[model samples]
Target chain A: MILLEEVWRTFQVGEAEVGALKGISLAIRRGDHVALVGPSGSGKSTLLHILGCLDRPTRGRYLFEERDTGSLSELERSALRQSRIGFVFQFFHLLSRLTAAGNVELPMMFAGVAPEERRTRAQEALRSVGLAHRAKHRPDQLSGGERQRVAIARAVVMGPSLLLADEPTGNLDRASSREVMELLERMNADGLTLVVVTHDPDIARRARRVIRLSDGTMEEEAP
Target chain B: MRAPDLLRFAAGALSGHRLRTLLSVAGVGVGVAAVVSLTALGEGARQYVVNEFTSLGSNLLIVMPGRVETTGSIPFGGVTHDLTLEDFQALVGRIYLIRSAAPLAVGSETLRHGDLGRTIPILGTTASYAEVRHLEMASGSFLPRRDPEEAGNEIVLGTKVARELFGGENPLGKLVRMGVWRFRVVGVAAPKGRSLLGFDMDDAAFVPVRTVMQAFDRRTLFRILLEVRSRGEMEQAKREVVRLLAERHHTQDVTVITQDAVLSAFSAILNALTLALAGIAAISLAVAGVGIMNVMLVSVSERRAEVGLLKALGATDGQVLAAFLAEASLLTGAGGLAGLGAGLAAVKILTAVYPAFPASPPAWAVGASLAVSVLVGLTFGLWPAYRATRLDPVNALMRR
Candidate 1:
């Protein structure tokens, strides 16, 4: 579970100050399938970055499992991200040189897993996503749907409690998008908390909870 | 990370762009080759000079007339007519450190042994020339004391000259023509090979000093070769020779030089040559560094999204830095190894083509070249690696 109180994020473009996220308060519970939906420049990406621990709010108290993430050092924050969080992107950003299995094994490598154990886990992760036969293929060798499956397997390989996907099906066709959405739904049903950021109403309709944003402010939360 | 895993990753990454990596590595290879080749040349020339000086004997000294100029022309055409028999006698009798003194008068003349003839070098000296020069006899004897006094028409053939004229047969007591003078071969000197000046030491004929003076009509003294008791007394012996020569010649223009002085002068010349070569090699290294930097900057720009992806996936800033550093080092290290191989191959080729010239690469040159390659890698890689590590994950991921 995670909590944010009075979160504020500001940026400076040349000489003028701009607020990307202002006074946002939210809570994410275990096993909850949540969707944050907003239009372009509505601060949805900024909120996702904060939730992923890739960025810190300028003014906020962020708690991850009762530990004050706001007070954590940079190294501790990196360790937290490595151990308890997984991220997926719309572009399916995988290492060009690495195969699907190699991309999945990256998180285990960061955690100092033994090579044999990392290999077994990576293979199992690929198989769970119906990509076992494509384990040795690089991202460029895979189709759009297969690349997103590989990305999902990479995200869940570390057995993280929280999965944050930013536009998980943004770049796929309708059928491939449905397949990727079904994969996320299956994982959420298997007790992994999922948070998705999207602008599609049909995609947001599947989540158990929906949080809508407008102009850096949370406008509605529905369950 | 474990070294094996790091190496595996590096291999995978580098192999992904084989042509680019090889080209970068080749740049480094050329740098190392320049360093090794130039240093080897310096070492070879140094050895040649040292060998030449050692061949003249360690305790030997040469007393020349007139001062040696550093960078200016000599008005008297050097010390050709300065040294004389009187100066040689004064040093031998007055200098306590002198073991023996041999006055040498040298010239070139055509030699004939029966039907075979060739133009060879001729040295005219006393019987003491053998003792002063440490000359060994292969067969027969050297000129006797009475030979110089009686102006004996006898000659000692060098090993090569003897081999050329008589093949395997003995030439002692045989008559040979030396500039119209028919002289009997008294003895065959041992083989001395060629000196560093490219002159054949074993291709000369030696006759008594009196015979050369009377028959060849040679009167001007060339060089006075002095053999001292030991190397420790060389400085004292040279001082005494200079003093005696200065007093006899009634001027201080004469020079007394020891083997150590000659060695130092040779080392100085080698030092200058080494410096010049090292400077040129340094420019090659700089160019190699620039090539590496250029390639790495391009790589960083192209891999911006990958860098962000890694950072988002939990790679620390240090890990990103180390990855780039490792890539650069691997490239340059390969280059260093290639350069070393190429340089050694060159040395081998030169040795096979010209056995008389020394062309061996020394251990120091190899070590220095390797060290320089690593340094170049670190220096050129730091900037690009820093640029990559400082990239914001948000901006980098959003880059097209």
Candidate 2:
């Protein structure tokens, strides 16, 4: 479970101050699939980043599993992100030098998992994402869909409880986007909390709940 | 984190940019070669001088009346009116520590044979000069002690001087005019190569000291060369010589030096020169270090994205730093080894080509070169590695 109370995030662009998220309150229970929908510069990514513990809110209390995240040090935050959360980016930011299996094994490596277990886990994760055949192929050698699948496998390899995906299908075609969405829905069905940020109405409609934002303010929550 | 893995990684990275790595490594190689070759040249010269001095024999003492400067232009104070033939006689006849004493008197005189004439050195010594100075007779006999007592105008020519005067014919029993005196040729000494002063000892003619004194009308003695029994007795022998000479000449300002003492002083000077040359050569190593730093900075800039990916994959800043440092150290270390091998091979080639002068690379030179290379790696590597480690993961990830 994740909770944010009166989260106010601000940024400094040269001489002026800008508020990306203005006093937003939200909570999502464990196993819930949520979609954050907003226009460009509407603070959805900022909210997601805060939830992922990648950035701290300028003024707010963020609680993950009933523990306050604001009190954690940078190293503790990194460890929390490493062990408890997984991320999938819109651009499919897979490491260029690593093969599909290598990218999937990266999170487990950081967690200090045993080498044998890491390989087995990476293989299983790749299989789950339907990328087992492309395990030995580097990102440059794989198709865009396969590359996204490899990124997904890397994101979920650590078995994190929360999956934060930012426009996972933004760069994919309709067929690949459908396949990626099905993969995320299946993982959500397995009881992992999935929070996806996107501008597509069709993708937002598929989630169990949708939170809409407008100009740094939460507009409404719809089921 | 393991050494082999680090090495593999460095090898791969270096090979990825072959031209850059080679240029940097070549910089270090040239630096090392410069250091080794220049220092070896200096060492070779020093060795040549030491060998030249050693060939003159050891544990002997030279008694001169005045203070003699070992190097530079000859000073006027070296001339003294203290030493005489009586001092040499006293040491040979009275001093218990004396082994053998040879009274030496030297002057430049012109010798002529028919139309050919040349200025030749005339060394006047007794019959014991052959034994004390290790001179061997090449063809004719040496003058006897009785010859000097009888004031016989007899002389011995060196191998080169004999050839110059008599040509292909035998110079034994041939008469040559030396400074208005027709001296009989009693012997021809064996050919000895150039001395440390660059004077050819084989080009000089030797005659009895009494004959020179009587012929040249010279009363002042220049020096007395003494052969001691052993090096351990040099101090005792010198003290006795000084005491006997001071009593006869009635002057305490006399110079008596053992051969080993002179050699030690020469060694000290040569050691200082070697160090100075090595120090100058070390500057090249510093320049090579700057080359490494420059190349590494470029490498870090080119591999920004790769570095970002590594960091995102859980590599700590320290690991990134260590990786770059390892690359630099490996390059410099390899350069040092290659330079050392090249320098030793050069020494071998030189020795083979000129057997008279053999150069040996000292152990300290090798050790110092290795140390200098490592220091260069560290000094030049730190800044670039620090820059790579401090790059922002977000910004780096965003870089194409």
Candidate 3:
């Protein structure tokens, strides 16, 4: 469960205060698959960042699982992000030096998991994302879709409750994009909540519910 | 994050930039090597001085006629009572700690053998001088044992003196005249080079103490050297000798000091020399630290996106800083090890090439250089690591 009431995210651009997300109120149930769709500067990524606890809202009450994130200290916020939230970037951001398994082992590593268990769990996560055979390959050695799958495995390796993905398949071909979406949908069906930010209408349609944003405010929501 | 994982992550990032890593490693390596090798030379010099002092006789104590710290009768009195032959004889008979004694009656004079004449320092000492000072004879025997007050005609030529006078044709039994006395050369001292006492032992001639006193018309003995049975008895012996001399002279007019005192002074000087060398070498290490800082800054800037990605994966700011710091430490740590090997190898080669110097690294120097290397890594790596952690994760992630 997530809640954001009257959230205003702003940035200081030189002398002017620019609002990235203005007065956004939204809610979603557990295990919900939601898509945030907008034009280039419509605050979709900012909203995703706030929801993932990477950034706090300027003025809002944003709560996750009944805990108000605004009240948490920096360390507590990081702990909350580590234990309950995962993020996937558009770039697939895999450390080029690491194999797919090593990439998946990262979050658990930051979570202080032991190396042996990290290896085992990372391998299992990689297998679940259909990257079992590609676990030994680095990001550069994998195809675009396989890289996204590896990123997805890394995201979910810690078994976080919420996964926020920004343009997960932005660089993939149509076939590879569909494969990545199906992989994410399968995880959601297994009761992992998913929130994706994208400009692609097709990817947005695949979500169980969609939220549209214009400028800095939420425009509409569709079932 | 676990420490090992953090190190692994940092190591992996370093491996991504092989040339950069190698350059910084080399930078620190050279600094450590300088520290190790220079300290080796410094330590070697100190040990050499120590060995020289030990060879001069560890238990030897000298009784100078006048106290260096005091003047006789408030600067307007007659010269301090000279150390007399009677004083030497009395100390020899009474001090049970005196294993051997060398009564010196020193004077400089020109000596003539046939048509050759050269001015050389003359040392007048008793027969026990050779045994106490560990002097080796090039040929013939030393001055015969006689009463300290009796003048003898026997003489000993130094290596250089004999070479200058006799030209290797065997100076034994040859007569040398000094200030009107023709003394027969009974022995020649072997080449002993320079003693640490600042005198060239190879360039001085020896005769009986009474001979120099009689020939030079000197009324007092130059000094008395008392060799103790063991080092442990020096302090007690010095006190007893000073007490006996004060009773005889009615004043403590002599300075009695053990060879250990002079040795310690030399050791202190040489130790400071070694420390100074280490300090100079440490400057190089700091310069290398600056190099490490520069390279690490570039590495941090280059890996900006990775920092953001790490934060997104739940790495805290401390974790990011630690990761980068680990990378810097790894660079300098490996460099320190490599430099240690290189420096020790250099010292080994130097020792092999010149065995006389005994070049080698001291344990403290080795420890300090290694510790300083890693400390340099931490100190210089701090700023870059801080920069990495301060990066805004959102802006960093936005960079594709």
Candidate 4:
């Protein structure tokens, strides 16, 4: 479902040219559960950003569904990201002013869903996450696990084919982390291609495929 | 998102920061209120002046002595007393369109009634002066229509003069002494308050014009008040007056002023003043606009994470810009309405406190204030909304 051919990403910090991702090549088929694992400064987040179409590569090609994403205009890229890809941040990133249902309905709003349908689908998504009773609660009012569940519901509300989670349980306690991981695993098992970037070995070992990076270059890939 | 949804979202975002939203709204409100109330004052002043002029009677003309229009060739030392009682007589008998003519002779004299003495301005005119100038009588009769010499010894006391001289007792038929003449008060004038030039019309007395001329040893009338048959005849009457006066005096040494000319000139000056006042008040609205801009910029910076999240959820830069602009427009629109209500209340209070003040704000002023507020919001809100659009989604989220 996604392919990267010798992709490179560099940053100009002051007078120094810092290569965040150097000569990386990878591929992942549909319905695959992949974990991108690396230490700090290893370009794990940067690589995930590239995969999610949130950042552009400095060199080479990024193909999603056999279409080159590098040549797409900014508007076209935004549309592609909207309809096909979903992102879950470690912080959950739920709008503090909006209720859980509002957060779940946001992606569909961007997708131009009818208001009545959006309301119904938002409630359904919340129900799937076991947060239907808390749908009217704001993110700050919810527990850490509940907030993450809201974020997950929001991510899947648009029915995207690809889901990218960056340390989705980084701020959660052990039990909450396990619940979030199991929720993600269940979604992946239902055939939504999931790519998780994490430092947790337990979470990484549960993935069907693992890619490790060091010093901005891929060091190992285990199937 | 749909337009309604976008508005809803923006409103929700603004409501979350209640104090900031209120302050911005108040800024716009004060601006609109300033515009509304100041224009009301200006418009009120204009209406007051127009009302005063209309109350002085319509289709009236004043023929004053002196050549107001001077030619360089006419030379100096060419002063002339061009208006007289004869000219007034000519208009009464000769001019076909002249409805009435009142010759006026004014003087200041001390009036004595028993032990009380007061200095009062005296208007010297015929009986027609009352009808021509729209002056009402309180009791008895106005300068009686009779031989000038016989009417000369009788006087009509104004309301204030009668009040001061006789207290509550009827002053009619009472004797009052003016200078060397002992006059019998035949009538009391109704209260006319203050006329133009700060002269209290209610604090004076009226006598036959010949009486004043004879007492003051001056045959020249101060002014001749001419009443035209209708408003349509005013221009023709003025032309005939100039011709008749020029023929009588052997020179056009007179100025004929139509009520309309004076009214138009006053209206022009008052209109300009009203515009200037409104312009000065509009500046406050601009200051309020700057306040909106400041608040919007702060709001943009504070909501960087939300902006990033929206972008990540696939909102275009255009969508974000539209959202913020909508928010700004909503703030200003609501504030403008509130300000309009406040301004109307203020005008009402002012009119209530001072019943004589016109204090009615014009309709265009209200509409204009509202339009300007929305425009100010859009103009001031650009930079912050642009900043929001330019934020990179990934970097914004990573900023923590």
Question: Among these predicted structures, which one has the highest TM-score?
Answer: 3
TM-score versus the correct structure, for each prediction: 0.80, 0.80, 0.96, 0.90
Instruction: Give the count of colliding residue pairs in each prediction.
Output: 0, 0, 0, 0
Q: Per-residue lDDT of A1-223 in model 3, one digit per residue for the tens?
A: 9999999999899999999999999998999999999999899999998998888899989999999999988788888778789888899999999999999998899889999999999999988988899999989999999999999999888889999999998999999999999999999999999999999999998898899999898866646
By DockQ, the better pick of 2 and 4 is 4
The most accurate candidate by DockQ is: 3
User: What's the true lDDT of residue A11 in model 3?
Assistant: 89
Give the higher-DockQ candidate: 3 or 4.
3
CAPRI quality level assigned to candidate 3 from its DockQ score: medium
Best candidate according to lDDT: 3
Candidate 1 deviant stretches above 4 angstroms:
B63-124, B127-151, B155-206, B210-256
Candidate 2 C-alpha error for residue A59, in Å: 4.3
CA lDDT for candidate 4: 0.87
DockQ: the better of candidates 1 and 4: 4
lDDT of candidate 2 over B25-88, digit per residue (tens): 8889878877787778778878887887766767578888765445447556333456667777
Clashing pairs in 1: none
Could you tell me the lDDT of residue A161 within candidate 2? 87
DockQ in order: 0.44, 0.25, 0.80, 0.65
Q: Higher lDDT: candidate 2 or 3?
A: 3
TM-score of chain B of each: 0.74, 0.85, 0.94, 0.89
Candidate 2: segments with Cα more than 4 A from true spot? A1-10, A24-139, A147-221, B1-4, B58-60, B67-81, B89-101, B126-163, B167-173, B179-181, B184-203, B227-237, B247-251, B258-273, B342-355
The i-RMS of every model, in angstroms, reads 1.5, 3.7, 0.9, 1.1
Q: Give model 4's TM-score versus the native structure.
A: 0.90
Instruction: Evaluate residue B174 in candidate 4 and report its C-alpha lDDT on the 0 to 100 scale.
Output: 91
